[model samples]
Target: MARQTSDCPFCAIAGGADAHRVWEDEQVVAFLDTRPLFPGHTLVVPREHVPTLTELPADRLGGFLAAVQRLAGAMEHGFGAAGSLVAVNNRVSQSVPHLHAHVVPRNPKDGLRGFFWPRTRYRDEEHAAETARTLRRALGGSS
Candidate 1:
């Protein structure tokens, strides 16, 4: 098991601090990104505190990706997005020093031309929850 850090925000969320949690299992957790590229943007992370993908145990990679796959589908179907942009930053541009895969909902003309991400915000918590509910249902349950 990766050691949990005392000050990692992702760890705090994984440890049950108030977060807009979208999906979770024994090994992973998915949550809405507070500053999102799109409203339904989600972050899929391992519960263990690995700082980068290379640090993630091989056995956990499959399960982590499985969760990311489910979230990608949910982003497309639940949010009515045309597709999704799934990516992971190793150490560069990784605002949070944890292993997380970004699942951003995409549309044809959403104005996101390239990797130059211009983030947008949810209208409010209700909006965030509504998005979360949609993803949760698409994920098959709160679990």
Candidate 2:
């Protein structure tokens, strides 16, 4: 087990100083959002105190994502959400020093907007899909 050295909420939770427990494993822990952006939104945090993905040991990354995948399936069925977004804010926008993923459930008419950007245009969906597939395969399995 690692010890906390910061006041980050994730660090506190990992250190057993908070009380919003929901999921936990050797390398990762997930808990319901206290200030949820949507219903059933949860945060999946790495147990180790690494600040970001680039700082994490390769071995720990799998456990972190495995936890997120578990929550993704459960969120869709449990909350009736159409899709889910596993978002992470790094660098300039990072609120907490510790890296965490926001597993947000998205449903049609959920009053949420798409993650698309204003300056973006869909020139080709097929190419995009193919590229995504290649990336998924490279990342282990098709996600």
Candidate 3:
């Protein structure tokens, strides 16, 4: 993200302009995604307000992904998301150049049929919990 953070929507969200905050720090913020594919959909953005992944400082990249991992895991276990897809677009689908990640929750029986990227439900709550636990430990959440 080359553009200045003030011109970015993520900056506004980071500034606490009325957002459903899930997690936040000085450099990153996580909140609910309004137009969600499933419940507990969230977006994690850098507070520095870079427009794309390439612009993020080297040290900050992992932190952002860590947030995504933690949130995705939590959604899987708590919300029974079943499955999830995390995507970061550059100029291709980068509607907001502020380097935001879309953590979309997926369900197997949701009637969402697509051969492109098939998603299956978690085997059971235990399966989901185990996955979340692993992610939490790896991503620097509450291990």
Candidate 4:
């Protein structure tokens, strides 16, 4: 069920508030990000006022992700971008509590490093492999 609060900006947008809407349907909405990483950066969100991805109902996850995928393609085709960076912030650095996926258009040598954090290398190949193994174990060996 869709929940809209008067205070949440996303909910306002979802409820037909003024925004640069790129796409909208019964399931989700896509709009230009107010503070864009690039000219074509867009935000995709479920119509429901879900605070985070984990809170989004399982049945809605696929459709929401598909909407994000569609927006990624739009970033390339609509803005002539070579590719796009899709990201979701759960809590940390989440400027808003509403769940949103950022689709930032990308080109070669964009100079925007991953989250602008200094890149670091693993101690060695074994160290990298061990990190992957740990994650695999946490995921019940799904990998």
**Candidate number of the best TM-score:** 1
Q: Report lDDT per candidate.
A: 0.90, 0.67, 0.68, 0.74
Write candidate 2's Cα lDDT for 1-143 as tens digits. 77555767787888776544556777887765555666456788887788887887887888888888877776666555688888887765667888888887777776666664122222355433443343233224433
Point out the higher-scoring one by TM-score: 2 or 4: 4
**lDDT by residue (tens digit), candidate 1, 89-134:** 9999999999999999999999998789898899988999898888
State the TM-score for model 2. Answer: 0.74
lDDT of 4 by residue, 91-140 (tens): 99888798999887789987787667332455555544443343233223
**Order of candidates by TM-score, top first?**
1, 4, 2, 3
- Model 1: lDDT equals 0.90
> TM per model?
0.95, 0.74, 0.72, 0.78
Error of 4 at 130 (Å): 48
Runs with alpha carbons beyond 4 Å of true place in candidate 2 = 114-143
Q: Which candidate, 1 or 2, has the higher TM-score?
A: 1
Looking at candidate 3, what is the lDDT of residue 73?
79
User: In candidate 2, which residue pairs get closer than 3 Å at backbone N, Cα or C atoms, i.e. clash?
Assistant: none
Runs in model 3 deviating more than 4 A are 1-4, 113-143
| Worst 10 contiguous positions by lDDT, candidate 3 | 130-139
Between the candidate structures 1 and 4, which one is better when assessed by lDDT?
1
For residues 107-129, write the lDDT of model 3, one tens digit per residue: 77776555344334555555444
